[model samples]
Target: MTEEAQRRLLVELGASLFQRGYSVGSAGNISIRLEDGYLMTPTNSSLGRLEAARISKLDRDWNHVDGDKPTKEVFLHRAFLDARPEAGAVVHLHSTYATAISCFEEAVIPPLTPYFVMRVGRTLPLIPYYRPGNPEMEPAVHAAAKGAKAVLLANHGPVICGATLIDAVNAAEELEEAAKLALLLRGMSPRLLTPPQVDDLLTTFG
Candidate 1:
């Protein structure tokens, strides 16, 4: 996509997430990988009110080359992109359900549905708590991201990688739904998809 197209799409998707409450109060960031660099939401910008022309642009080396300043959490996006070479976009969102689920230390949501499995992958890595926007966590996140496309940051939220911006957003949304299902099913004996079923889904859709 052209830079203009990417910026417009980011504004649209970001607004969609914020309006529906996946993000609120300038609490999320989205970035798209470009052949020359990246297109990202500006720092302190509300996802709901992004200006396409003012979206931040960064060169491959992470320099801010145009538009507004990039998110302070740029390191978070870089970590996932560097670790997952095939990823073309990344999104970090403070969605309520997923953030609530992240508070737990070791709660891995089971594959309660096939869409969740296909979109979110088999394992959601839980990165130990790191203060948000702390570049110190980049190395740790980068290491964990190497093994999973979606990871829940302890007490923070989810950082997801995708083949495109929409893919990342869709996966993040699916994860939120999966977390909601897990919480709703708590204390009940919910039958999760078996290993072979999960493997089949991964093989077919991952």
Candidate 2:
């Protein structure tokens, strides 16, 4: 895709996620891969009102190439690019439901429900909490995201990666829904899918 197209896609996706309450009040970031560099949202910018032209661009080595400075969470973006070569886009959002799950003690997003297991896989590993934009946080997320497209950051949020921008956004949205389901079912003795049932779904939808 052209640079302008990438920027427009970012703006549209950001707005969509914001409108859906996936991230609010400038609390998330999005990025897309490029042959020479990458495009990302600017720091402190509201996803609901981002102007495409103002998005930041960083070259292959991560130096500023165009527009304003990139989001402070560039570390996490770089980590995903380094670890997951096939990830053409990455999205990090403070979606309420997912972050809520992160606050729990064990912090393991168990695949108790079938839909979550089938669409997002068995577990959304929750890495130890790290301050937002902290360099250390990227390494932990990168490690946990191996072989998985989505991960719930402990006491933080969710980071999703995909081969396309839309796919990444879809995964993040699905993650939030799963988290919401988890919260609603907590302490209610919800009937979780059996291993064989979950395996069947995984085989069909995973």
Candidate 3:
């Protein structure tokens, strides 16, 4: 995507997220990997009112290439992009349901539903708790995100990677939906898909 197009997508998605109550103020961050560096939402900037031209750009070596400072979790973003060559965009959101699920001690998001499996694969592993932006979190995310499009940071939020901005957003949304479903059926003796069903779904979608 052109730089201008990338910037506009960030602004659009950022605004949509704030309006939908996904992340308030500047609490979340998003980024797109560019040919040279990356285009990212600036630190401390309100997603609801972000200006496209002022987005941060960071070089491959983590140096600021343009605009203001990048998000503090830049290393977190870098870790995934480094490990997953398919990652073109990354979104980390403190979406309510996902974060709430992340707070649980045994927060394992299973392949409860077919749609979740199709969109995010069969697993969204729970990375052990680490303070936000901690170097420790990066490795944890890397480990959990293997063979998965999304991973939940214990007591933190969800980090989703995709081949495009919209794909990343959609994956993030799916994580939130799965979390909501998990919470709603917390102790209701809900009928989770059987292992065979999960395997079939993964074969078709994974």
Candidate 4:
């Protein structure tokens, strides 16, 4: 996509996520990998009201090049993109259900449905907590990304990567639904997909 197209799509999708309550009060960030570098939401910018031309642009080395300043949580996105070269986009959101699950000791939401396995993979590890906006969390996130496309930031939210922006957003949404299901099914023996079933889904859809 052209730079302008990517910027427009980012704004459109960001607004959609924000309007749906996936992000609120500028509590989330997004970035897309570009052939030249990256385009990220500006710091302190509301995802619901992004200006396409004012989105921050960074060089391949992450140096700010144009538009507004990038989000302070740039390292979070960097961690995922660096670890997964195939990833074309990264999304971080403090969605309610996913964030609530992050607070628990068991961070890995089980495969309660086939879609969860198809979109979010087999396991979602909980990265050790780090103060918000702290670059120190990058290494931990990067390490976890080696095994999974998504990881819940303890007490923070979820960071997800995908081959494209839509895929990343879809995975995040699926994760949120799965988290909600897990919470709703608490204390009940909900029928979950068998390992063989999960393996088949991963093989077919992943």
Candidate 4 structure quality by residue, lDDT tens digits, 34-64: 9999999999999999999999999999999
lDDT of model 3 at position 90: 91
lDDT of 2 by residue, 19-126 (tens): 988888989999899989898889999889899888999999999888888899998888787788988999999999889988987765556766567557776677
TM-score of 1: 0.98
lDDT of 3 by residue, 1-206 (tens): 69898899899999999999999878889989998888888888877888988999998887898998988888778877887888899999999999999999888776677887777877777888887778867777776666677888888888889889898889888888988998988887788889899889879776
TM-score of each: 0.98, 0.91, 0.94, 0.98
Candidate 4: residue 89 lDDT (0-100) = 97
Displacement of the residue 39 alpha carbon in candidate 4, Å? 0.6
Please give the distance, in angstroms, between residue 19's alpha carbon in candidate 2 and its true position after superposition. 1.7
lDDT assessment of candidate 2: 0.83
lDDT against the true structure, each candidate: 0.92, 0.83, 0.85, 0.94
Q: Give one digit per residue, the lDDT tens place, for model 1 in 68-184.
A: 999999999999999999999999999998899899877688899999999888889888888888899999889989988988889999999899998999999999999999999
Clashing pairs in 3: none
Over 4 Å off, model 4: none
